[model samples]
Target: MKLCILCAKQRAVLKRPKTGQQICQACFYHVFETEIHHTIVDAKLFRRGERVAIGASGGKDSTVLAHVMKQLNEQYDYGLDLFLLSVDEGITGYRDDSLETVKRNQQQYELPLKIVSYGDLYGWTMDDIVREVGLKNNCTYCGVFRRQALDRGAVMLGVDHIVTGHNADDIAETVLMNIFRGDIARLGRCTEIVTQGESSIRRSKPFKYTYEKEIVMYAYFKKLDYFSTECIYSPNAYRGYARTFLKDLESVRPSAIVDIIHSGEAFEIKSTVKMPSQKTCERCGYMSSNDTCKACVLLEGLNRGLPQLGIGKESRVRKQIAESEQKELPTVVQHFSQIQRDADAPDIIQPRDPSTVYTPPPRMPTGVLDPPTKKTLDW
Candidate 1:
C-alpha cells in the first residue's frame, strides 16, 4: 500500500521482506540505503567520527551503493567523512574505461575519490600476473593482492572500514563456491557484515541482500552512471559453469539466489570441525592461521620466481617456501605438490563461509588481449 515517491504511483512494493521498513521499489532503493546507514550506526560499524570509504569501481553496484550512502549521510546526519576508494588495476581497455567512470562519479556525487593502482601497490598489474602465472589460477593472485591493496589504501587514507558493493548474488556465489570447496570455517563466518580487523583495515558489505539485477535496474531507471567493461583475462571455466548453473536455476525458481542465501544462513556445520586458528601474519600483519599470509607467501614466491609459495597448505607451502630459499625446484611443481599435501590435510580444511558463493565469470576465448583489463574487474 506504499506510494511511489516519484509520480505518486502507488505500487505493491510493500512486501520487500523487512529490510528495516520496506517501501516502494524507488523508495526501497532510497530506504534500503538508509537502513544500511542505520545498521552501520546501530552496529557501530564505524566510529562516531571516523572516516569511511566506498570501494567505488564505477560499476553499477558500486555507483548505486556510493550514491545511496551519500544520500543517507545527508538525510540522517551520519557524522562521517565519506569518500570513494578505487583501485586502478592497469588493464588497458577494461580499467581505463572504469577509471573514467570513477572520475565522472566523483563529480556527480561530489565525493572525494582516490585511486590506488596495482603498479603502485605491488609493481605488477593483472597483465603482469597473467603473463607470469597464466590463466589457471591467476585469480588467486588478483584476489589476494587487491584485498591487501585495499587495506593499504585505506590505511593511507586513515579510514576505519572499507565498504564494498557486494550484493546477494555475489555473496550467494561465494557461498556456493565455498560449499563446493568444503571450506566450512569460512562458511561459518562469511556473512559477517563487519570483518573485525587486527592488522588489515576492517571491511564490510552493506548490500548483502540486494540483488545484482535489481541494482542494475535501479541504476538504469535512476539514470545513475557506471562502468560496464569486462576483464580481459577472466578465464575461470569452473566459475563460469557455476554461474550458468545459477542462472538456469534462477529461471526455474525466481528467488533461487535469495533462497541460496537463506540456505547459507540456515545451514550449520558440525561442532567437531576445527576452525582456522586466529593468528597474525608476521610479514604483512594480516589475519592468518600461520606465520605468514597467502599474500606474503605469494609475494615472496614472486620475488624469487618460485610459484610454489603461492599455493598449498601451510606446512606444504611452508616447505616450498623453505625449498625456494635453498634448492632450485620448479615452483609450479612445488605448487602442485602442496596441493597433494592439501589433499592429505583434511583436518585443516574447513567449510568455506556459505554467504560467499563463487560465480564463474563469462568465458573469453584465449587469443590476444585487445583492451587491457583493469585490476579491479573481479567480483
Candidate 2:
C-alpha cells in the first residue's frame, strides 16, 4: 500500500486533485475541513455570535458544507448560531425525498431547520408549473422562484448570513455559461465568495474554492449522512453542457476549475456597458431588475393563462403586453375618460365620444407654408 504523503504513517487512500498528493483518509478529512476553514477565515465570512443559515439541499455538497461548518464553528470558536434553511420546490418525488434527507441532517447535525415551500409562497408547485409550461423552460421558473424562496426562508429563520454549497466546479461552470451567453454582469459576479442581493441577509459560498470531487470523497470517507440524487425536474441542458465541458477540461488538467474561477474573478466589465439596475417588484416587493420580479411576472402569466409571458426576451414580453393593451384600448380609454384632465392641456383631445371629434383629410404641401417632407424628417 502507498504511504500517506503528509503523515508517511497511514496508508494512502486518495490523491488530491488540487494538489496531486496521496494522502490517508484521516489526513484528507483534516485538510478538506481546514481548507474550507481557511477560505472562510481569509474571506472573513462570519463574525462572533452572528446568526447564519446553511442553504441545505441535502445533497453531497450541502451536506458536506453543513458538516464542515459545524466542525469549524466549534473548533475555531466562531461563536455562530447556525440553522439549516431549505426550500421545498414542491416536486413530488424529488424535493420530497431530499427534504427528508434535510430533516435527517437537522437531527444529525443538531441544528434548527426551517423549510419553505413554493406552493405556499407562489401558489404553484413545480408539478403544476411543469404541466402549465411544459418541460422546455421549466428550469427558468424553478430557478427564479427558488432564489426568492431561499431569501424568504432565510428571513423566516432570522439569519444574518446565508451560506450555500456552491463549489469551485459550480462557479467555473457558471463562469463558462455566463461567458458563452455573453452575460457580462453575471460573469463578473459569479466568482465572488459572497453575494448580497437586495435582500438583507447576505449569502456566501464558503466552498467557493473547494473542488466537487474532493467534497464527494470527503463525504464518502467520513461516511457523512447526505443525499445523492439528481433533481427529477432538472434537465438543465444548458448548464449541463457547461458542466460537461468544465469536467472534461478538469479531466485533462485538474487545475482548470480553479483557473476558470480565477479568470472569472479577473474579468473587469467596461464601464460603458449598461448593466441591469436592481428594483423592487411592484407586485411582491422582492428584488428585481424590472418593476415586477421574474417570479411575479411568471406567476401572473400562469394565473392569467398566458404562461409564456415571461419566458423569453423582456422586449418580447413587453411587446405582447402592449399589444394586448392596445387590443383593449377602446374600453380603457372610455373608462379613463371619467377622470379630470389638466387645464393647461386643453388641446389634448379625449376619445370619449368619437363621433363628436372632427377629422381632417391629409393635405398636400405646395409652398413656403409647408416644409419639405425630407427636411421635416431630417429635423
Candidate 3:
C-alpha cells in the first residue's frame, strides 16, 4: 500500500493537483483547511465581531467553503458571526435542488441562512428570462442579476463581508479569460484575493489559492453534503472552453494554475490605459461604470420586449434606450426608477416617488475601453 508522503505511516488516498503530492485523508484535510486559513490570515479577511456571509451555491466549492469557514472560525477564535447567503436564480430543477443542499448545510453548520430570489428582487426569474431571451444570451441576465442579488442579500443579512468559493482553478480560468478578451480592467483585479468594489460590504475569495480537486477530495473524505449538478440554463460554452484548456495544461503540469494566477498578478497595466470609474447607477444607486448598472440595462431590454438592448455594444444599447425614450415608454423607465428610488433611501426612511430620486452624474475614469475593435459579446 502507498503511504502518504507527509505522514509516511498512513495510507495514501489522494494526489494534490497543485503539488502532485500523494497524501492521506487526514493529512489532506489538514493541509487543505490550513492553506485556506493561511489565505484568510494573510489577506486579513476578518475582524472580531464581524458578521460574514458565505456565498453558498450548494456546489462543491461553496459547500467546502462553508465547512472550512465554520471550522476555522471556531479553531482560531476569529470571533466572526458567520451566515449562509444564497441566491435563488429561480432555475427550476437546478437551483431549486441545489438550494435544498444549502438548507441542509445550514442545519449541519449551524449558520443562519438567508436566501434571496431573482423574482423578488427583479420581478423576473431565470425561467421567465430564458423563455423570453432564449438560450443565446440568457446567461448574461443571470450573471448580472445574481451578482446584485448576493449584495442585496448581504444587505438584508446586515453582514459586514461576503465570502465566495472561487477556487484557484476558477480564478486561473478567469485570468485566462480576461487576457484572451483583453479586459484590462477585470484582469487587473481578477487575481485579487479580496474585492470590495464600491459597495460598503466587502466580498472576498478565501479559496483563491485552493484547488478544486482538493476541495472535492476534502468534501469526499469528510462526507460534506453538497450539490454537484451544473446550472441547467448555463451555456457556459465560452468559459467551458477556457476551463478545458486550463485543465489540459494542468494535466501536463500541476503548477500551471498557480503559475497563471501569478502571471496575472504580475501584470501591471500601463499608465496610459484608462480604466472605467465606479459610479452609482442613475436608476438603481448601485455601483456601476456606466450611466446605469448592467442589471438595470438588461432588465430594460426584457421589459421593453427588446431583449437585445444590453447584449451587444454599449452604443447600440444607448441608441435603443434613447429611441424607447422618444416613444415615451414611461412604464419601462418608471418601473426600474421606482425600484432604485426606493432602494436608495435608508430602510428607516420612507420611500419617495421615482421622480424625487437623485443620483450624481457619471464621471470619467482612467481605464480605456477595449480598443475600437469589433468584438463578439461574451453573452
The lDDT values for all models are: 0.67, 0.76, 0.78
Give the per-residue lDDT digits (tens) of candidate 3, residues 224-331: 777776777665556878999998998778799999999999999999999999887877777889878898888878888888889887998888888885452332
Residues forming the 10-long window of minimal summed lDDT in candidate 2: 328-337
Measured with C-alpha atoms, the lDDT of residue 293 in candidate 3 is 85
Where does candidate 2 clash, by residue pair?
none
User: What TM-score would every model get versus the actual structure?
Assistant: 0.76, 0.84, 0.86
In candidate 2, stretches whose alpha carbon ends up further than 4 angstroms from where it belongs are: 325-379
Relative to the true structure, candidate 2 has a C-alpha RMSD (angstroms) of: 22.9
TM-score of 2: 0.84
- lDDT for 242 in candidate 3 is 92
Worst 10-residue lDDT window for candidate 1 reads 337-346
**What lDDT would candidate 2 get against the real structure?**
0.76
lDDT string, candidate 1, 1-379, tens digits: 4444444664524323222232356665665565667666766676657678899887888888898888877787777788788888777767766667777678788777777788876667888777777887777887787877677667656677788998887878877888898888878777667786543467888787776655665665577777655576675745666677877876567588878888888878778878778886765566677776777678667767875566756778767756654553232211211211112111211223423423223222221112334222112
Q: What is candidate 2's lDDT per residue for 123-230, written digit by digit as tens?
A: 888999989988878888988988888877666556789999999999999999998988887887888898885456788999999988788777776777666767
- Those runs of model 1 whose alpha carbons end farther than 4 Å from true positions after fitting are 1-44, 198-200, 325-379
State model 3's lDDT.
Answer: 0.78
Worst 10 residues of 3 by lDDT: 360-369
